[model samples]
Structures are given as structure tokens and as C-alpha cells.
Target: MRPVNATDRTPADLLRSALATDPARPLVTFYDDATGERVELSVATFANWVAKTANLIQNELAAEPGERVALLLPAHWQTAVWLLACSSAGVVADIAGDPSAADHVVAGPGRFEDGLACSGERIALSLAPLGRRFPQPPAGYADYAVEVPSQGDLFRPYAPVDPEAAALIVAGAELTGAEVVDRSRADAPGLDLTGPGSRLLSGLPYDTWDGLSAGLYAPLAAGGSVVLCRNLDRLGEDALAKRIESERVTATAR
Candidate 1:
């Protein structure tokens, strides 16, 4: 089996490559039009978040390789962090997945009740600006914002992640880590993410493969970045145009 490394065998590898190439470059710029909120994460900062979250998954949750983690979250930046964290920890992330069968569950405020169905460790994300913790912690659920801060800044999976092992389940398809990387590389050119400083503006949700590819994977595979927009339909054309220009977006997937 191929090893997961920075040269590109998995999504974690893509993130590592980005961090190595330009740690200061903004990797993910997120906007919540409804709340008029914006946040930007550089490659280094993003990697730190991934590392800490991966530590939380591997140590606190004790989630081993091949364990399924139900991600009941949306297209927020924290959600993206969790996606890569799962890769780093050698766990399978099931997007909008069934919680009951998962080894662990990461849920947003809206999906808190649903995550209760899971028998394993449960984590909740407030998804608030600056990753603020919940005002009051939910019963039986660890608050991600609170717990992640205490985790290690670096992560190394207890068990090596097999590039050929299952990594993601999305939109009715299961993809191994290697396959996800391969597909992302293939999708980059078509998504117009092969150019220098390619920045994609994506208003798509995270439920489907297309959304994940355009919003996160494709840009990472191409050594580019993304501007993730939530409630984008609520933004007027004028506002959207200004955002495109201000964000230096070269591609769009809505």
C-alpha cells in the first residue's frame, strides 16, 4: 500500500503540500452572507487546526484507523478542518452521514439531536465566528471549540493511514484516500484550478462530491485556494461581484 505523504496520496497530503509551498497564503476564505461574517485561514493556521482536531480525534475519541466519523456539519471552515482532520487521523469521514453506525460524530448546533443517536464519542461544533464555544455545553457532547484548544499543535496518527484505505463517504459513493486524491487531481483542470494563484469562489454545499471537489479538494490538489460562501444566494449580484474582486477569485462554482 502507498504511504500517505506530502507528495499527494491523500487529502492530508494535499494540505501538507500547501503548507510546505506557502504557509502564509490564504487557503480557505469563508463568508456567511446571511450573518455578514467573513474569516480567512492561512495554510499554516489551517494546518494547526487540522493537527489539533486530529489529536482530538485520535486521543480523546480514541478513533482508530478505519473507524467511521459521521460529519453532521455544513460547508463552514470548521467543517473543512474536520474533513482534513479525519484524513490526518486515518479515519473515514461520512458527510451528512448516519450517526447511529459511526464510531464518532461531529455535529453542528442544528444536528445536535441527530448526533445523539451515535453510540460512540460525540463532538459538537458551534460554528460561530472565531470558533467560539457554545454558551452552554450540550449534554453528552464535547464542545469542539473548547476541547481543540487544549490538543497538541502537531498530530501523528497512532496507526499509519493507508492511502488505499477508505477515507470518505459522500453523495452515495465511498472513496479511498488515494482515490480521493486522484479524483481531486483530475478535477482540478476541469474546475479551472490549474492556474497560478487559482482561487475558486464556491457557493455550493458540502453534501455532494462536486461541492467538496470545488470548494476544497480540487483547489488543494492544484495548490490553489478557495473562497467558501454560505447563504450565498442571499447576496445580491453587486455584492457578489465585489466579493469576487476583493477575494481575487479566478474561478466560480455555484
Candidate 2:
């Protein structure tokens, strides 16, 4: 392997950076609107969460490095933690709305129908009823949301990971068939998630690329915190500005 250098960046680099500077800082938080669940991670906990999650994925899901593990999830705390875990393991997470038929689908019961519909296998991270509950959880799927915890979890001791590589595939400014016909294609941008003072106010729908990438991956990649709201519109002009001020978020890209 080439000697690690500044140019040879990876997702693990971001985690390490956060660890060095402010390991106890708040990196990300996910709030569940339905269950009122709040999941929070500090820089150190964020790092560990990713490691354990990655280890589990590698061991159980056979998520080889660079293999795209797709997430069909709403903006839940578990989903946020999984994003961090995927990046740490160097597994490419599929956030594309147009998932191929063969992709492994992981989703919550009620909110992730599209994810479940598209996935070959399903995993539930929580025990809460997902509206029209399935007679039984999908055969190949496992309930992981409730199984994994932030501390003393089975995978929590996973070793630290490298930072430079395809931590996750980030999508930006994508247009649909009609929208593409009408608009231009910009090389989708990667928000420097691990950049300083990164915090998220995810006001977008989970299924949308911008929502998932910008709202989710951006924060996880940089070891930053995710600020979730039931609806983006809830982050109105004043509320958004106030939240930013309160959080002291830096380098917002929007």
C-alpha cells in the first residue's frame, strides 16, 4: 500500500481528526418523530459506533469493502449511526432513490416501504410497529435497530479504521428523467462532512438524494451531528437560523 499521506484521504481520517480534537463533542443526533426516540453520539462514541457497525456488517451481512450496502430508512438515530458504521468499514452505502432490483434492502417497517420493496433482503432496526405490520418480518431480514446500542454493544470494541477511501457514495443535485431533460448535470458535490463544527438540520425527505446525502451522510462522514425534524419546513427561516446559532455549526453548504 502507498504510504499514507495528506492527499490520500479517507473517511476514517475524518473520524480520527474529530477524535484528536474533540472526542467528547456531539457529532450527530437522530430524532424519531413517531417514537420520540433520540439517539446521540459523541466524537468518540461516533467512532466506535461506526467500527462496531462496520464489523457487524462485514461479519453478518458479508458487506465486503467497497460493496454498496443500501439503506432504505427514514432519518432515524439508528440510520444515522449505520451511515457512520458503513463509512468506517469502507462499504459503499447506496442512497440512490433508484435502487436496482438486486440490492439488499434495509428499512424500518412503516417508513421504508420503497427501501423494502427494492431490497433483496430486509433488516428492521426497531421493534415499533410499522403501520401495516408484516405478518412476519421478511425471512432473510434481521432486526438490528433495537439490537445495536451505543455502549457495551457486542461490536463496540471494533478497532479504529482508516479515513481515506470511498467512505460512502454521496449524491448531489440529481435530476429525475423530466428534470434532467430540463436541467443541467453538475458533478454532484461532496459536502466536507468531517469539516469543522459540522451539524445537520435535515429538513428534507429521507428518500430524496439531497436529504439522505446532505442531511445524513454529510454529517456522519465528518463525525458531525445530525439535526432531524419531522419536516424540513419545520426549519423555517428564523428557526433554522436560530438552530444554527445555537449549534454553532460551521461551513454549511446549501
Candidate 3:
């Protein structure tokens, strides 16, 4: 693995580099057994989503660097977009914390009621098969599908973010943007993510370090891609193996 100057670059920077290298390579493939949903995004497509999401965060929500954005989501593809959006906007992602304390909250259908308790701005995602617009949006919350499409495909933060700013608060641990980048670079080799073509099958939940590494950080750091599975516990061993074979997954973090 190459040494990264974490003090100079954030996770979003790494993703941009990856996009430059191979825009057509698959960056994320998501699976939801319960919903029979499967979505694949190339680097360019994923980056487009990230840009729109970041624009939403910066322009609509007016979230600033170091602000906390609570993410009440599963290991779905849209969840990954939100993660990168927060990083790109220099907002701290809170995956396992009190939503009410966050400056902004993004919630899925099941967590909509709990998200309403948050005093900050809220965005609700239906997590529909095609990421469809919420049929009946909550009274006060913005619907992600309704707003994100109108945002710009390119994103530029209002101000440059400090690498030392807090970027994530997950599972009782706070990590700066620099720390997150450094750890992702360091963890990639150990995770057997050596190059761009490497594909990782991750069954881990996003709230844990292992999950974040496999699902987002490690892949981006190594210029690789991820196959993220939600409700993976429902898959039988045979089914799992078939998926690994079909997706051509080279590594797994479960």
C-alpha cells in the first residue's frame, strides 16, 4: 500500500482520484434480499450521486464543516451516497448516536418517526427499489428523491475543509477526516484490497469500523469497489457463495 499524507487529503479526495482513474468501473453494488433489490453504480454514476447529495447538504441544509449529520439508514446504496456526501461537505457523520442532537438527520422509512424528534433539518428516503420519491412525504421533512434530482451534478464546498476536522462519530468513537483517511489507507492492505479491480463483499453493518472500512473507506482507498449487502443474514450459505461467484467478489468482510 502507498503511504497517504492524511493531513492533506480527505476521504472525498480519495474518491475523486478513483473517479479520475476509472470512471466506468463499478464502485458500488447493493443488494437487499428482503426487497429483491439490486443496484450497481459505476464510479462516475456514484460520483454524480455524491455531488448532488453534497449540493443538497451544502445549499439546502446549509450544513457546515464539523456539524453533525445523523444517518439513520441501513447498508444500502443510497446510504453510501449519504456517507460520501457528508464527507464531501465536511460534515461529521453520526451513525450510532442520538439523532436529536445532530444538526441534520437523514432517515429511512422505518426510522421516519424517530427522525421527526430531531430538532434539526430532516430528509427522508424511502429506500424504494429504484430510490423512488416518497409517495407521501412527511409533514416537515424534505424528500430526498424530490430535491436531489434538481441539484447540480457537480459539487463544490463553500469553503475548504480542514483535514483535522471531526468527520465521523461511529460506535462511540470520534474520528477526524484525516484519521479516517489514514486508517482507510492502512486498513486496505490488511483487507486484501490492493488495487482498483479488487471487489469486496461486505456483510457488516455500517455502524462498526469493520463495516465502514469494507463498505466505503477501504475500497475507495485501494481504488477498489464494494458489494454491500443488507439483510445478508437471510441468505443461505449456498446463496451467499453464488452471489460471491456471480459478483466476482475477491474479498469479504463479514
TM-score for every candidate vs. truth? Answer: 0.96, 0.63, 0.96
Error of 1 at 219 (Å): 0.5
Per-residue lDDT over 157-243 for candidate 2, one digit per residue giving the tens place of the 0 to 100 score: 144433433444435332222221111111112443444455656656655556655555456444455666553453458866876
- Tell me, by lDDT, which candidate is best: 1
Model 3 clashing residue pairs (backbone): none
lDDT of 2: 0.53
Candidate 1: where are CA atoms >4 Å away?
1-6
Model 3 residue runs over 4 Å out of place are 1-8
> How should the candidates be ordered by lDDT, best one leading?
1, 3, 2
Decide which is better by lDDT, 1 or 3: 1
lDDT of 2 at 7: 27
1-254, model 3: which lDDT tens digit per residue?
Answer: 43453443788888788787789999999999888899999999999999999999999999989899999988889988998899999999999568879888999878888887789899999999999997789877999999999999999998997878899888989998888888888889888898867899998999888899899889988888999999999999999999999999999998
Q: Residues 155-218, candidate 1: write the lDDT tens digits.
A: 9888778999999999879999999999988888888886449999999999999999998998
Better of 1 and 3 by TM-score: 1
What 10-residue stretch in candidate 2 is worst by lDDT?
180-189
Candidate 3 least-lDDT 10 residues: 1-10
